[model samples]
Target: MAVASVTYLTRLAGYIALRNRTLSPRIVEVMEAAPGCVLISVIAPHFVSDRPADLAALAITLFAATRLPLLATVVIGVCAAGLP
Candidate 1:
């Protein structure tokens, strides 16, 4: 597809451009943080909305995330969201 080709070319261009350069530590740190930032971006909409259910689930998940493992936090979020 055209989209896929464009995406591949775009990534290839970045790779070629950076091929001879050493990434700075700051850039590495930002790259490491990218996934978590993306995750927050995805979940952030739920936090900004006025829905009680989403707010409660986000609160429960945030609390559990601090005290529990990733699986437990996800389970708690799912359970909280499923509550009627």
Candidate 2:
């Protein structure tokens, strides 16, 4: 339909634009870290907030993220956030 055709053309245009381009190693590294940087930007306020429970949850989530797999980290983070 109309939506599908628009989506396809948009993707095709992007592919054509970048088909012959190569990113530098430094740029690639920065791009790889961008998601984590954005995540921290979003969460930093809550982590530094005045709420004790939120602080505790942030600490637990940070520790879990460093030591556990993605699924486990998310599970522990959720549980920590829900703790009294």
Most accurate candidate by lDDT: 1
Q: What's the distance in Å from true for residue 39, model 2? A: 0.5
Least lDDT summed over 10 consecutive residues: which range in candidate 1? 2-11
Q: Estimate each model's TM-score.
A: 0.65, 0.64
Please state every model's RMSD to the true fold in angstroms. 5.5, 7.2
| Candidate 2 local lDDT, 8-66, one digit each (tens) | 56556655766688978886576556556656666789966998999999999999999
Off by over 4 Å in 2: 1-20
Q: In candidate 1, residue 68 scores what lDDT?
A: 100
Query: Ten residues in a row with the worst lDDT in model 2?
Result: 2-11
Candidate 1: tens digits of C-alpha lDDT, residues 25-81? 987676556556656766789989798988988899999999999999999998999
Candidate 1: residue 43 lDDT (0-100): 75
